[model samples]
Target: MKQRSEQSQGTVYGFLAYLLWGAFPLYFAALKPATAFEVLCHRILWTLVVCLIALAATKQLRFLRDLARDPRRLGTMAVAGVLIAINWVVYIFAVVTGHTVEAALGYFLNPLVTVALGVIVLREKLRPLQWVAVGVGVIACVYLAIDYGRPPLISITLALTFAAYGLMKKRIGGSANALQSLAAESAVLAPVAVVILAVITARGETTFTTQGVGHTLLLLSTGIATAVPLLLFAAAASRVPLVTIGLLQFITPVLQLLCGVLVLGEHMNLARWIGFAIVWVALAILTVDSLQATTRARRLARAAQGAAC
Candidate 1:
């Protein structure tokens, strides 16, 4: 019963995380006159501030000391920080520049990119169905390229950078909790963020100061916007099964896609629709394969327990 309750809580946490993430395009779109770069810098610095406060409140500052002593983990987190920074800037650019649909497509493609990264970087082998799903994903990309008259660079970059960031987090493993990890990443990028803000201010191009109180508050609120969903996701991950997490991940991209098409009024031609359809087919294939694999693993565990008894 406790486990079931935990799982239910996790589902709620996961849903809220994805819901907030899905609504990000609207938030970012509202931050007009602030260039993506300016927004990213503010995001990094403010997120660091928020993380520090959370760490202090939770009495988890000791993790920072531990992280400092571990050079390898620190270095890995630094790289992860860079990767996430890239992802953030690109995503913000997509949202602010009327490329929300492309942003949605990128997230939709992220799981497949993660699978390919596992095979290439982690030396993991894909199951037959997984391979087929990946193949279909490739075809979808090709179709999208043909339809767009060029590769979907925004989508591809978002997918690749985010997948690489995930790999870095995987390497970090359980060495750090989500709050600690985010704090460290933000710290690593804080110096650069400071410099960027300074440059923007010097050039008189910063929207933070010129944009009125409400806009200034909106920019400041980016910190909470970035941190809350991540914390919720961490909470969900701790409580839920991997399969549940996997299934719930789709909520984010699906919401983004809906926001882009229905809310943002992004134009989606027939070709683009067909391309998205193909990607969905690949995702469906992958989902089924993951579910079956989880079931088999559970069955094997049960059979082993029965044999031992």
Candidate 2:
């Protein structure tokens, strides 16, 4: 019963995390007076503040001390931070500039991008089905590009930057848990974020101060918006199976797509819909391949256990 309860809780946490992430378009849209760069800067600054507060509150200051001592880890995290900042700014630009559909497409392509990156960067071997999935993803991009008369730059940029970030995090291994790593990344980026804020303020184009109480509050909430879902995702990951996490991850992009078409009223003609359909088919193939592999691994483990007996 306790195990079941924990799994249930994990599912809820994972769902909530993805739901919030999917709904991020709405949140970013609310910060109208702020440019994507301004929001990105504030997000970095405030996320650092929140992380510091959490460290103090939870007595996890050791994370900071340990990070300070490991120059290699710090350097790795610094690179990861910059990559993530790029991802955030681009995503924010999509949301705030009426490109939510393109943003959603970006995330939809992210998994396939990650898989291709694994093959290239990690030199991991892909199964036949996985290879087919990747091929289909490429075809989808080509189709979309032809339809648009150009490459979907926003989508490709988001996928590449995020894939690079994921690779960096994976290379880092268990040097820091989720929260500690986030705090460290934010800390690494904070100085640059502060400088950006200063420049914007000097230009008298700053939105946070001039935008009134509601807007200021919305800008401040970016920290919470960034942190809370991450914390929830961490909690879910700690308790759930990897397959479950993989499946849950799709909820985010699916919701974003819905928000784009339904809420934001982005135009999706037959060509765009066809492109999206191809991507979904690719994702389905990948999902089935993953499940089959997992099943095979489990069956092998059971056979080995029986042979030992």
Candidate 3:
């Protein structure tokens, strides 16, 4: 009963995280901001503000002090900060430009790339099934590339940049919290946003309208919408295991796929369906291998304890 309850709680957290992220496109579209760049600026600027609020509420100021003292960790965070910002910009661009279909593809391809990067960068060994999973996923992407007659740059960029951000975060030691890190990163970029706003206003390139209060308020709320899900995700991450989180990541892509087809009215072609099927099969294989691997690790640890006595 206790086990079931724990699992249920984890499920709830995972679901909340996925649901928020999955529904993000609708919120972004509702904002109807000037351009993706403007939306990106608000996302960064407001995300920073949200982070600072969380940091204050949590009293993680001590962590901030330590971060200020440690240059190495701070430097790594700088790289992570930039990559995540780039990811934010690209994602907003996808939503704003009505190419959410491409953004969906990017997220769908993210997990496979992260797994492949683990093998290449961390020198992790993949099980047979995992290797096959990786192979199938790669083949699917290759098919897309060939069929499209060009590389899937948006998908690849989002995947690789996010994966790199993950890696950089992993390497940073100590209490450099995600929310705090994001806030700091956004703070770093805030000046550029201010300057751009100034330049655009000077050249009459700014999109804000004094005549419509509703539209202006909607644009401003993009920050809250962008920041809230992330805060929820951070809260959920502590309560959930990595595998659960990994599985939940699929929800965003699945929703995007639905949104692309139904809302955006993207056509479904045979090649696209076949490619998606191959990717799904690969992910299934990987998920099974991961479950087995986790079980094996637990058993081995118990056996080692028994031997120790």
- What's the TM-score of every candidate structure? 0.99, 0.98, 0.90
Q: Would you give me the overall lDDT of model 1?
A: 0.95
The per-residue C-alpha lDDT of model 1 at residue 279 equals 100
lDDT of 1 by residue, 5-123 (tens): 99999999998998999899989999998999999999999999999999999999998888889898899999999999999999999998999999999999999999999999999
The sequence of per-residue lDDT tens digits that candidate 2 reaches over residues 1-309 is 999899999999999999999999888988986999999999998898888888889999888888889899999999999999999999999988999999999999999999999989999999999999999999999999999999999999999999999999997888788888899999999999999999999999999989799999988988888999999999999888888989999998888888888998888999999999999999999999999999999999999999999
Ranking by lDDT: 1, 2, 3
Poorest lDDT segment (10 consecutive residues) of candidate 3: 172-181
Q: Which clashing pairs does model 2 show? A: none
Instruction: For model 3, state the Cα shift of residue 210 in Å.
Output: 5.2
Model 3 TM-score, all chains together? 0.90
Question: 234-306 in candidate 3: lDDT tens per residue?
Answer: 7667766777887888998899878877886777788877877877888888888888888899899999999
Candidate 3 Cα misplacement greater than 4 A, ranges: 1-7, 62-66, 305-309
User: What's the true lDDT of residue 36 in model 2?
Assistant: 95
Q: Superpose all Cα atoms of candidate 2 onto the true structure and report the RMSD in Å to 1 decimal.
A: 1.0
TM-score of 1: 0.99
